[model samples]
Target: MRYERADLMTGMVQEGLQALVDGRHGDPFSILGRHQYGDLTVVRVLLPGALSVAVIESETGKVMAELEPIHEAGIFAGLVGSPVPYKLRIEWPDAIQETEDPYSYPPLLGELDLHLISQGTHYELGRTLGAIPMEIDGVDGVRFSVWAPNAQRVSVVGDFNAWDGRRNPMRLRAQAGIWELFIPRLTHGERYKFELLDAHGNLLPQRADPVARSSEASPSTASIIASSKPFRWNDADWLASQAKDRTREGAMSVYEVHLGSWVRIAEEGNRSLDWVELSQRLVPYVKKLGFTHIEMLPIMEHPFGGSWGYQPLGLFAPTGRHGTPEDFAYFIDRCHEEGIGVILDWVPAHFPTDVWGLARFDGTALYEHADPREGFHKDWNTLIYNLGRNEVKGFLIASALEWLEHFHVDALRVDAVASMLYRDYSRNEGEWIPNQYGGRENLESVEFFKHLNSIIHDRCPHAFTVAEESTAWPGVTNSVENGGLGFDFKWNMGWMHDTLHYVSDDPVYRKYEHGSMTFGMIYAYSERFMLPISHDEVVHGKGSLLGKMPGDAWQKLANLRAYYGFMWGHPGKKLLFMGCEIGQETEWNHDGSVVWDLLDRPEHAGIQFLIRDLNQIYAKEPALQFSDLHAEGFQWAVADDAENSVYGMLRTSEDRSSHMLVMSNMTPVPRYGYRVGVPDEGRWEVVLNTDASIYGGTNFGQMDAWAHRSPEHGKPFSVALDLPALSTVFLRWRG
Candidate 1:
């Protein structure tokens, strides 16, 4: 009986040692460290570089047993009748060290966390799944968790472990497919990544944490352990005031900026301005511009700068190119204090094919679809997310919430929404797959947007969402319950294209294309539109707004000023790119700063002053912004004046007590007397004239004109005004 027991014990020891050597042990905890065998206590350890191993009682510092080397690969085992708590005294070739066994600790992730993750309902996945600092059993450490179901093994590798995958293999949490490990003595700021082995036991590329709040700069894709220091925000009043819906009724004049190139430090090798510097510089600049909000290009972590942060790898992490996550938070807080809201351009449409990113993570299409037809983005050479998967959808939704909740972002401007809505976007025949309904619409993406918007509205009621959808998808701004995608606003791409086309033409040809300026009003009330002359219009050889004007330098400046007045006066919210305000002559270059020196010239400085005044007038006047989403707020006073290259419109307040008359003349020929109809017979004051001498334009219009009772153009009153050449005029009635 004793020999039979001895053989059984020997077999168990051999199996444990072989499993350790092969790296195939599903539960290293069961075989490693100390265990009791009836009357005897056995201790085993696998120290890859150790020359000898001794089992010592942790409390008394007494050696319990010297382990015998059972394998040449540093597998040691011995009998030790020690107390419950013990440590391993490992002797290397040159040094000695003592530490607790990683495998002996209890599971770091709880069952509830595993269940929530598998169910795709973990809203705070960022806090739970990433490298989170914590205190486990009075030991300071970081609890790392990741979801890599198809991986044979996932190990946390970093400087602490000498970048050795074999040093700390995470324990799998059953069918939840989550691997977790709590490494003692691990602290903040340590960079780490998941070293994965595929199902076939082949080594794959190490992947950064998908939910990392911070990451190393581009070209180095490891995720750094974020500090747990609490952020003290002074924007409590700002947050509370935003509880109401601010998209529709509130004035929204947005200034779109590309952070990296907006302003660079010339002394620092032309490096991009950090978030702290932006807080000091950008906030004051936007405030001076009178813009209600600043819509930034995607600030997520992307490897390539040429992509302009559109091809993002880290959805949850802010780009370390600017600064740490806390610095970004500070910037947002500063913006709020200055009464300027910040909106982030979020890219969930596709991700780049960087090997260290989410591409073929764990040797499988975990975050994206397996089939290239459905997963590939042909235009960008990127991979589309598999939004049909519950976890992927949840991850994206969590990303939106993370920015809004943690960073206090006011809105998410979803990028490339048109591409996300269509499966055949930018694809030829046979290059794309149809949905289950045999339609071009991407059903998964549609449902994902609905879910995402619904959750955001429920949790962050103050925040809003905008879609960069160029297509005329019906009900984009409608609520989800009405079978719509549920965006608060959609970019009026049609308006942008038509207006740019119209303005680019000479006055001789503009009369023939009169519908270009009038076509937007046909459906202006659809989907709560935002008229955006975004970065897309000024980049990629599409010259600057000023360059697009087909005239000499003076006419070009005059045309730009006229267009600005027209856009500000037109129905819907406004979004102008950074350099467009100052009439940047060159196309946007992501590598260079805005033409700040251009402000020294009166022509450029005048445009800047005009934009500031336009914002102030737009915000102060209710007729221009109060009922922008409703058709009742706008009416054409002279829509059929294409023959004279002139257009006039009337914007009325909600109560119908006040109104503003806006008229634009496309030609450079000044009209001495142009009859413009008014809403009431009274003194119509010219509040803003784009041709004012203050704006570097030929001052040729009166400040105030009396409207006689003589009816014209189907109105009760008429005013003979001196319309300036190639300029727009704003007239406020004092009835």
Candidate 2:
């Protein structure tokens, strides 16, 4: 009986050694770690280059037992009297290294964490997955975890293991699809990637941690172990004062910026400003410009700088190109301290096909769909997320929550929402798959948006979401309980298109396109809109907003100022791209800095000053902001005077006491006696005149005027004022 048992043990050791050498061990912990057999504890280890190995007491330096090589491949095993805390003393050809056995520790992930992850409700996946630094069983180490259900074996490989896949094969927590291993002495800043083998035993590419908090810079796609040191935020007051619902009935003028190109140091080889530099330069500038918020382009980690961060690889990591993850948090905190909200441009529509990214993760269609018709984004050559999968939805939703919770981001502007909502977006008839209901809409994406928005709103009451949806999707801003998309605001793309087209035409032909100026009012109150002249409008040969305007340099500047004035007074929150305020003459160059030198010219400075004043006035007066989302806030005093290229409208406060009259003259021909109707007979003072001499205009507007009791345009009062050519005027009534 003793001889038979010895033979069985020998056979078990040989089989384990072969499995380890082949890297086919699904549960490395079961065979390699210390295990009790009868009255003795069997210690086993697989150190590829080790000459010899010894088991020693973890507390004391006493040698417990020496392990004998059972196979030529450095498989060491020995029988100790008892199982206790111990470390492996490995001797290479010349040097010796002592480290705690990784397999001795139990599973690091709790059952609850696994359950939450499986159900797609793990809001704190960032802290649970990835390489998390923690002290487990009084041993300081990093717990590496990854989701690779289809992988036959997954191992954590890095400098610690000489980047060898066989050194640290993880223990698979079966049905949950998570593989985790706690490596002792692994601390913060250590770079690592998961080396995965496909189900067919074929080695796949090394993939970065999907939930990594920090990552190596582009070109080196390994994820780094980040310390979750508590950040000292000084924006409590800013957060406390924010309204639970921030989208409606408040002044929201967002200054959209691309961080890399906003300001670059030309003297330093034209390098982009770091996060600290941006906080110092950008925060004060946005505040001084009177913008309530600064909407940044995507700062998530991506391999290509030219994609402008829209194609992100690391969903949880801020791009290391600018600074570390903490640096980004500091930037947002600084913005909040200065009473400016920071809205991140989040891209959940598609992701690039970078090898180390989410594409074909685990050698299968894990994060994305397998079928190209349902999975591919043809326009960008990217992959669409498999939103139908609960785990994928949890991954995305957790990403959104991480920004708002960990980084204190005030809002998220979901990019390319139109693409996500439709299955046939940028696809022909046969190129797309219909949903179970056979509809053109992507039902999974719709469910994702609802789930994402509901959780974000419920958890972070002060944080809101804006949709960059170009379609006329109804109920975008309605509540989720009301069967809507549950976004706080939707980008007014139709308004932007119509208005830009109108301004691009020459003044002589402007009368023929007068409907463009009045067309937006038809759906102005549709879905709590945000009038966005975003970065998309200025790039890709579309030209800068200034370049898109008709006529020579002077008229172009004047038209831009007038257009801004009209936009500010329109019934929607405002979002002007960076450089539009200064009238960037050329198209936006993502590689270069904004044309800051243009401020040296009077015309450019005038445009900047006009935007600043517009923001200030829009914020100060309730009539311009109080009822911005309601049709009751606006009235067309003169909707049909297209022959003279004149448009007039009145903005009124909720209380009906304060009122502002806005008039625009699209032509270069000034109107002497432009009679605009007003609600009451009062002393009407010109609050802002875009064509004033101070703004490099012809100074064609009244400084002070009185509205007569005589009725005009079906109103009780009328004010006759000299309207400037290619300008807008704002008159506040003081009864």
Candidate 3:
């Protein structure tokens, strides 16, 4: 096993409280004490089978052979004292256990506890929180320290001095492997970042404030928060009074919203909605939509106006582009109060070209793996963490936990999960490192993610975590026991790709691939999934859903309605990109505003109504919920006018009394008195119609009394019904 040390501290007396552990390989690591409050030291010996363990003073290093055999499994005691550096070695003989599976090793829990022995009054200052409120007391002359042991030089940059990257350089404290700087008269809103110089005499990029309250757009610096906590959350009461019967998958109907574009501040001229305004207005709007959750695009600090929160600079900080840390926290609190769950679009797979944040952190591959083959992602122009490294793993795990604990987000939609799953992701053969197993599966990354999911579920049982995985990675959302990633839901990319292809084709061409609709059902059964219309489809010339359709205005609406109705009837959960419900005509533009004016037209209103009604009907339908999965819940067949491109199915319940029949005709020519098979003979009420006048659809069918009974077909009876061309109808049997 490899050994490492804890951090350094200063001005302290030394005392050993206990001999923490005795390794089977003759060595002893002890917990040492210091006089100063909250400071500790640890020392490790590398020899086999330590005969004994004892703390020796500098004057008595070779004077005594006092020792005792270590009996405990490992150290569970804390240490305190000035950090001191020392070493020892011993010998023993025993075969160590080696398992083929790397995960068989013992888990590392809590903060790491090991440091070199030292005697001094020189340690770096560190904060113990994710973000600080702008109200620290007597901290103007507080010392600042960073653990950039590899860097030769370090500088401080912040918003206090116009985004300067090197206004104040920190002095290197060599014995402890750190850099220290003190800024007097520092106040809140004084944004800051670090600039480091590597051993090669190269000035590394500026790093973002890991804990900024709010940040400018990406590429800008992070603000130095005053380092205080002031939010008064009744979390215990909140969790107790709350009743969450919502299944991570079943209750998942996400509204993909961009805080900036959802609403704008008219008073600020061109300013978009900040976190505060969005929190207030959006809670009611999202709750009203009947969606179970809201997924915000990347809200982390980033540079560049066009960034959709994808290229993140701040890993632990909420974007200052909106407001302060408190403001962001208030937003989350308000969301919880309104009973609207929020899912952050977390970008752990890659990061932006943030010199002031993560790039070349510590003037070397400190946060990232030193090897470019494993550390770099060329397509995204970002760095991938060395998931195997202890510190790297700790950083990511801590970051994830911070979001859940501090912000109280209900779920995390991990972005670009595919990139994290494979080592050679998006790279040619020569461009990536092969894992120990010599395959695309990055075992270390996979193991780390599994651990992450395990910890999240354990800590916050109600929290939902989803993966935006595009690849056909087996078991993306399966249980960890089944050797899966354990995401609550995985984006059904197959559904999106297949459905888009089928809808974009002409009627004649669609017939050839109409079966694509059922192709994704197989994957849906294996894992809980979300049929998402995420930002991926809208950005970069992919165009809007309307623009992707193959027909004119009427056909376009029909195609969209058909697609949505089919999705609602499908087994998986649903997610709609913003502006899609009202049928935004233009492609999604990150910078330009959404075509909100389009909703004024009746056509758009109709689409919106259909969506709303679908939500209502979906909630009430048992077949839409029961087994929402199993193949037994679904039945498919070609309509009698198969040549006209028609298909129908009945989403049936186990008891069969609560079945719903859905039929659609793609042809523009209406089919009068068409027959569809049903399970029973009863009065069928037209529960929902895609061609209703209310939804800007051509009035093709009567809203009331479109009932029919089934002929004696299979177990007992069957029925025939009238089908409208280019329309979908949901019929519920009223026995």
Candidate 4:
């Protein structure tokens, strides 16, 4: 069994030493530790069986130094420079049997306490995932401790304490490395924040709790989270069920959603649905949509109202705008009950504002670099992570693991991956630092991404890790051993852009531009991908799918149906934005409702029906499912000129027992009878149609037809009928 991210790190390290001496094993010593970064990491011995026990850095392949064993039982320590990759070499006089446990450490119950006694000032929360308990007999007297090696002082302030900013000061504890104080009396339903002092006694900026249960901005007060549980989850059954069926890579068809705008709340005047209520209603609806998963936009706590959750404040806390921590847990539990997996849209890429949680987290460029140019994102105006820093990396990695272990999320779809990969991704020449070759790729970020993927996959094998990688990075979807960033799937922007460009053109213009529509297929075969009409295509200047069509109402609906049909038939997996199935006309508003009334219209209803049918077909048809990523599932045109305006392909399986043919016309003019190639020659059946009356299109061809055998096309049978204008049809070979 590949023990990825097993909780046995400390144990393995401790036991490894005794076995090495007892057997005089001619094997490399296994040395592992939670590296400089708090990421529980292991460096195995590959060449100990060889003479030299040398330690080399994995990134630059430079030798750090020779190592010697410390005179202790099952304990070895070596000095290594930098924290990229540590390699250990073990040597023995002769080969011997394995006797050392090679793995030992104290119980890995790593948690720390963080406390602040003031508000409107900066403070350092201990930079680790060590659990911090409180003595809250009456919801008050909670002690906090943060490991700010550079901070001079720290304090905690909140609604319970009246945002005084000066009354309470956390007494620093030396042995525990915690700053703590016990307040006499307090209760739940109160908000709070922290303040920190730098080396020069300069007050650091105050920030919210990274794991806050809830938050509320108080110009005259700080954010508060009630220390109460208002939610009761059906977790016992959920864990029992999910433990059997976990997440898989291809099994995912995510519906990227924003909770606040997904449904409207009652008291908020159609503003946003409370997390509790939204969970109650959304579970069944998403399951019915046939989406296997839902990747929610950042649910992490952030302060900005208009922000799309790219800017995050609380690292471990769900946004208070929804409800509480338990509330979010209930939401996840509910989704699992409905057979819908949940993946958080995590943003560890960059933090919001330079005055809050991440801004000067430990003082003196602790979590971020000291150089403003290197530390800040100019366009985003956010703080970049000091990924090389040990504590920061640990905090981030632990947070990632915590979500998977605690929340039972099926996966994580990392955002802003392009920015993380290249230091100058959005910068011009001379505007950013370069790699060793003077190129733009940030090797540190690359290593961090690799490490992150390894940790997640190691810890949660069934949990998938996806990247929103925009650049054409090589081997993005390849396995890590192939020298690639390990992402199971990538969003196919090429398909989205090209398909939109093709579908938006007039039918008269489409014939001349058939190749344009099929341009995305050229490179789509390079990687596993998800063709998405994501929120990015709907917001800002880019209009919604329905709004982009250049035609009348019926024509627009028809265009959407054809576009979706084409997308479904194309070579990649599929994802549709929240309101696209109903032909929502308006662009998505992060602060407004989805205009659900559009479903009342026949045109929109027809579009919804088409999507429902398409999803049904996608589920029922194995040819569509397994063949989606392979070349055998898709075939290009045999006739160059005729194929340009028309796309023809047969979806065949490994055994070839059953096959499906999808024929689409990009041209506006109707063809009297089109000859499509099929592998088999028998009776052929028209099983599906994009121009069906249910999809708001006039039924153009015979709903039921049987075609006799034909020798010309190399198929068991051939059909001759009116091919509808700008419509797709699927035919299967019959016995």
Q: What are the Cα lDDT values of the candidates?
A: 0.87, 0.89, 0.63, 0.63
Per-residue lDDT, model 1, residue 536, is 92
**Residue 251's lDDT in candidate 1:** 83
Any runs in candidate 2 off by more than 4 Å, and if so which?
A: 1-13, 243-247
Tell me the deviation in Å of residue 502 in model 1.
0.4
Please report the TM-score between candidate 1 and the true structure: 0.96
TM-score of each: 0.96, 0.98, 0.77, 0.77
The reply for model 1, stretches above 4 Å from the true place, is: 1-19, 22-26, 33-43, 51-69, 76-83, 86-99
In candidate 3, which residue ranges exceed 4 Å CA deviation? Answer: 1-145, 153-188, 200-205, 211-219, 234-246, 265-267, 637-642, 653-657, 702-715
Model 2 agreement with the true structure over 174-229: per-residue lDDT tens digits: 86899999999999889999999988888888999999999988878999998878
What's the C-alpha lDDT at position 297 in model 2? Answer: 92
Arranged by TM-score with the best first, the candidates are 2, 1, 3, 4
- 399-454 in candidate 4: lDDT tens per residue? 67656766677777788888888888677767787668987877877877777787
lDDT for 470 in candidate 1 is: 92
Pairs with steric clashes in candidate 2: none
Name the weakest run of 10 consecutive residues (lDDT summed) in model 3.
Answer: 20-29
Which model is ahead, 1 or 3, in terms of lDDT? 1
Clashes of each: 0, 0, 47, 60
RMSD of 4: 18.2
Q: What is the Cα-based lDDT of residue 163 in candidate 4?
A: 52
Q: What is the per-residue lDDT of model 1 for residues 1-735, given as tens digits with 9 covering 90 to 100?
A: 233334323336677557656765556666666666666777777677788988888788799888887778767777777546777888988888887666667777778878778777778887888899988666678889888888888888998777777667788887788888888778899999998888888888888999888999987889999977778999988888887655558689999999999998899899999999999999999999999999999999999999999999999989999999999999999999999999999999999999888998889999988999989887799999998887788788889999999889999999999999999899999989999989999988888899889989989877999999999889999999998999999999999999999999998999999989989999998779899998998899998989999889999999999999999989999999999999999999999999999999998999999999999999989899865787998889888888888899899998988899999998998877799788788899889999998899988875688999988888888999888999999999898
